[model samples]
Target: MDISTDVWGQLALEASQVYLTEGGQVRSPFASTTIEKLPDKVLLNIFSYLTHREICRMATVCRRWRMVAYDTKLWTHVSLRPEISGLHVSSLESLLALISIRFGPSLRYIELPIELITHTVLHELAAKCPNLTHMLLDFSTAMQLHDFSEMQAFPTKLRYLCICLSEVIFMEGFMRKIYNFINGLEILHLIGTYEKVEEEEEEIYEVINVHKLKSATPNLRVINLYGINFVDDSHIDAFSSNCIQLECLAVNFCNKVTGSTMKTLFQRSRRLTCLLMNGCSLRSDYVMQVEWEKSSVQELDLTATDLSTECLIDMLTRIPNLRFLSAGQINGFNDSVLKAWVEAGTARNLVALDVDSSDNLSDEALHRFLSRHGSQLHGLVLGGMPHITDQLWQSVLQLLNNANDGRYYEIVKANFERADRTTVVRTSTNCRVSNYYLLSNYNDLIFN
Candidate 1:
């Protein structure tokens, strides 16, 4: 090794030795040795795998290790869980200070659970982490927050933001801030927000004016909004007009979205790719899928919607590139329509298919759907299809193997991921669902 390498080794050994020799102390495994004696980069590698809490603890162990742990890459991803206690306002400020001082520019992600995070902390974090790209904040209060105006000049480089607020007042300010500040954001997810209703004795139709929200964001690609209530059609209309560049849009459990209004958005936004409309009351007389001049939408998710399967299929076939599809819990989409979807137009590109929670599809229907298209299909989600047995799942896997080249078959339940060049499968006992997870050279399957 070079002199620089040897020097670092010596420093680590001496540091380790000091810790062991301190006090009438109980001797550790390396009581007489020092960190300097160990491989210089070995500890660095160990730091990479540790959680933020573990890394913070290790930073205080010794001066030599502190320097190594202070590497900017160590603080690239930050997770603030509600369950992990001992974080007060002051502590949060101090932690932010430390993080900013040590690795400001490299910071990317921040996760705080819904119940624990306060508005004060949110403001502080927004102020400090200017280069923040991804954030998940769950605020349980109904208070209207100040403009995240502090982040205006910092960097609107945010790509993904997931916010779960309990009250509409909180969203009013938050949305205003986002409209005023982060104009170039790509993917935005808003969930679980209550509406701001009138408490007075005389209250009529409420009009929420979101004209301030008309600014355009050309780069925004995916938008997922769920479990929120909007007062009227205009509010919903204003929100949709902002994200003209949307590709994948998911709005679940939203009470204010009308089917006609939704159809209007589909007509206007030409670049939409994947559309997920779940748990919404789209009880229109008839949902007519509007034709777009430059329709590029491929995947369509109509889980728990009121649209009939025939109506959905009629609307879907309009998009030429239609591929992966999910229609769970749509009582209207019967066996014939699904099988037809699996076999006909652009279905060859249909790699993943989910039909969970549908009382309409039976075992025979599912078997026919899978068996016919099993060769082309890579992922099949049959959750809440209580009629499907383990026997059927096994047959589907076997057929996929027979159809494709001799690639190893992999089964994933609950969640699955791809890392480096390998496939990782993790099963959860939360529910028994039939999934046609396979080992492919492509993307992973994630369900939440």
Candidate 2:
């Protein structure tokens, strides 16, 4: 190995040297010596497979493990998603302090549990983990916070930011600072927020205004906003004009955004790679698939919206690179559209296809679609297609069983990702509902 490799190896050994332990719960030092003497690189590899919780447990086994658990390399991808119950709120501050200091600059990715995030915590992260990049903050339970001073110190390296906030006040308050501080921000996703009614009440909400934020995040590539009632086509026009390099846009469950603005978005954001507008009040004529014929969007989800069957089919046939398509609750997204794609050979490239809740699709259409392209598909959401019978899943399993091709397993695995680090899947001999999960060994299913 080269000199750089040697240095890394030596660091790992110094970081995990086994020492005597007082805990009777741990295996005797001499007993585990064989495992401990392994090369430092191998030991690091073993630690890499462990989650934050598992590492915490391992740290208790021995003095040497405690050191290894705190190693900077092992703290890069951390999750603060654990729910803290029955403990004083001060415990959260302690935990955050420990993580920020011990993890150091190595921490890059973090996912905070809903309502647990606070202005103080974000500041701590920015100061301690200067290399932090991606952060997923859930605001479902987050307290109403309107401070933006700490956010001004946001880590310079921060890029992708997905904040699911609960208050419109907090959402609009932070955007101004986000653009100013997080200059490198690429993806800004703001989900629906809440407000109060009546002037007498302390709680009330106004529409989110991001018009001023354009000056800060001029290079933003992806924008996802949901339920901003005050926004109209003019806001979309301004965003399209300002964020000229936008590649992905998703807006859902909103009324102010008209179909005309969506058309302008489609036309202005020419480099867009993904578009999702679920429940946006877009006129049928404005969002015709023909408008997107020459566009570069690869992933499109227009759930709960209408597009002509002919338009759906035409878009599928025309967009050879479209890899992810979902039309849930949309009319004219029947088996015929799938057939048209199959005949055109464009469905072969699709990684995820969701026609869920499309009542018109029959079992025959799904069977033909799956048989022709099942092996290639990584995700298939088949729920709500009533015409498809239980026998359809059985036959799908049988096909995979006969050929041993593994598509059936892939579909099941794609359907749901296990949330916990340690997941024990138990498959039964007879299941009431079966679409793709018929594997004999549930534990053997590999997660992507």
On lDDT, the leading prediction is 2
Number of the predicted model whose TM-score against the real structure is largest: 1
TM-score versus the correct structure, for each prediction: 0.71, 0.68
- Per-residue error at 265 for model 1, in Å? 1.8
Q: How far is candidate 2 from the true structure (C-alpha RMSD, Å)?
A: 10.6
Residue 73 CA displacement from its true place in model 2, Å: 1.5
Per-residue CA lDDT of candidate 2, range 44-133, in tens?
779889777777788898888778777889888766666631112245667676666677789887777644465667677878888888
lDDT of 1 by residue, 137-189 (tens): 65545354444454333336676666655543434444554554567667666
Clashing pairs in 2: 115-141, 115-142, 196-203, 196-204
Off by over 4 Å in 1: 1-36, 84-93, 111-130, 142-155, 168-179, 194-211, 214-218, 231-236, 284-286, 292-294, 389-391, 402-448
**Residue 379 lDDT, candidate 2, scale 0-100:** 57
